[model samples]
Target: MMKIDIPTMRAQMAEGDKKRDTGLTEPTTITAIKELSYGPHGIENTFDIYYPVGTTTCLPTIVSIHGGGFFYGDKELYRFYTMYLASQGFTVVNFNYRLAPVHQYPAPLEDTNALMNWLLIHGKEHYVDTEQLFLVGDSAGGQLAEQYATLTSNPHYAGLMDFAIADVQFKAVGLNCGAYFIGQTGAINQDFPFYFGETLPEQTAQQFPVESFITTDFPPAFITTATHDFLKDVAEPLATILRSKGVEAEFHLYENPDGKELHHVFHLDQRNPIGKQCNEETLDFFRKFL
Candidate 1:
């Protein structure tokens, strides 16, 4: 197991994020419904949905998996970014999942599954076009999004997880600065224990590269990373791997026109022009399927 001060790290991350999101309000163009429960874990299992204001037609839905190292993050923190997605004429769902130290591997995954199911059951209430679903995740959330999308198409993996798959197909997924080969990727390697709770056998471990579980059935992907993203290396390789498996994958590396640096998950910043471009381009990718 990786050595980590779980409580302290959580506290520190929460503080840092609070400052990062200071004064940000939900977008005026989007209407948001907050904290609707979808699972047994109460708050941790709750989700929020965003919709373009006053739209009567069923819209393409985007389920957003937030990132904070898989241990910290909630729908509230991602509200602005997701609302932007809703503003683009998609219904967006962002949820809180049970975090590590208290919950393990399948917990967060299970919560995601539950949220997807809830959406299907409540489609009319949320103005979601269940058949036109898409997913987007960044950082650790990217890992969950990938894994969950895998579970949907890979029955064997879903069985191993002992969780039922979400009963919907994703038209495509946006993986933004995601960490894929979990156990082998540096800092992400250390968080493996935080994710799975215990070690597994060699064969099972081998499948965790996230590549082994992926098949041609996986959804097409739009993978992106900033010029200076810590996980920039993960993007292209994943795209190549997906294309090799006969899945459509698009890769983009956003370079700053200025000499300034663009760090991890920079696309989440609604105010960044480049970030807006990144978001719109991803939406464009999803539009191709629709």
Candidate 2:
């Protein structure tokens, strides 16, 4: 079993923050920006939008969700990535949903769905091509993205779907080191009680498992996992599930070229050769689909 050195990880995270502030490891630029709030859940339920300059015509949009174990991350932490995608000519929306231990299952998912509905309703006004919607998430965000896709497709969530402003179709989804399953086999399954307030019932837990929820109608997906990641098993099975359902799917496992690194190290060390290569491959994959 691979173990994460918490102290070393914290140091690396601090280093990344320093690099971000110094602009030495910034991603890219965005032309215009806006704040979006459509719910009554107070200021924390808001999102930021980034678009290219002079984009009057409808343009593709990518909604990015950040990850911090469902308890720590915020939209701002992912600004670099969103801005980079926006610079590539895709409108990018990054938002904060309610966190766990305060807001449990269905809350975060509902918040994301609300954001999606808001986007569809306001897409035309924002000059967005609602039909070309793409969902991208890293880690916890990826899990929510998959859940959102599943929820939107289910008739039980029809009321949620009815509020969508436009006839948006999810074209593709990108899962970066996502936690796709959340039961006994999950990496952080033990953390569920901490997040959910209590141990989840079997059925309740099943609802959050992307592998169990996926259907043939689920959109195409591109998923990535690091070889040394604790979550590697979490995402790989979902790729097989997607293919079995005839949904286009691609999965890549990245390993450290020097063979010395740990899970979730990619985002923290962007200058690392393997990390850079993974980002490049991700961009190339997006270009092919978008």
lDDT of 1 by residue, 62-153 (tens): 99999987678788888888888999889988889998757866677888888888888987787988899999999989988998889888
Supply the TM-score for candidate 1. 0.93
- Once fitted onto the true fold, the runs of candidate 2 whose alpha carbons sit more than 4 angstroms away are 1-29, 156-167, 184-189, 199-208, 265-273
Question: What TM-score goes with each of the models?
Answer: 0.93, 0.82
The top-ranked prediction according to TM-score is 1
Q: Number of the top candidate by lDDT?
A: 1
Worst 10 residues of 2 by lDDT: 158-167
lDDT of each: 0.85, 0.70
- Which 10-residue window in model 1 sums to the lowest lDDT? 183-192
Candidate 1: Cα lDDT at 49? 81
Model 1 residue runs over 4 Å out of place are 184-190, 201-207
Q: Can you write out model 2's per-residue Cα lDDT over 164-280, one digit (the tens) per residue?
A: 422456888888888776653653346555455455555455454446656788888888889778788878888888899888888988887677865663653444667666666
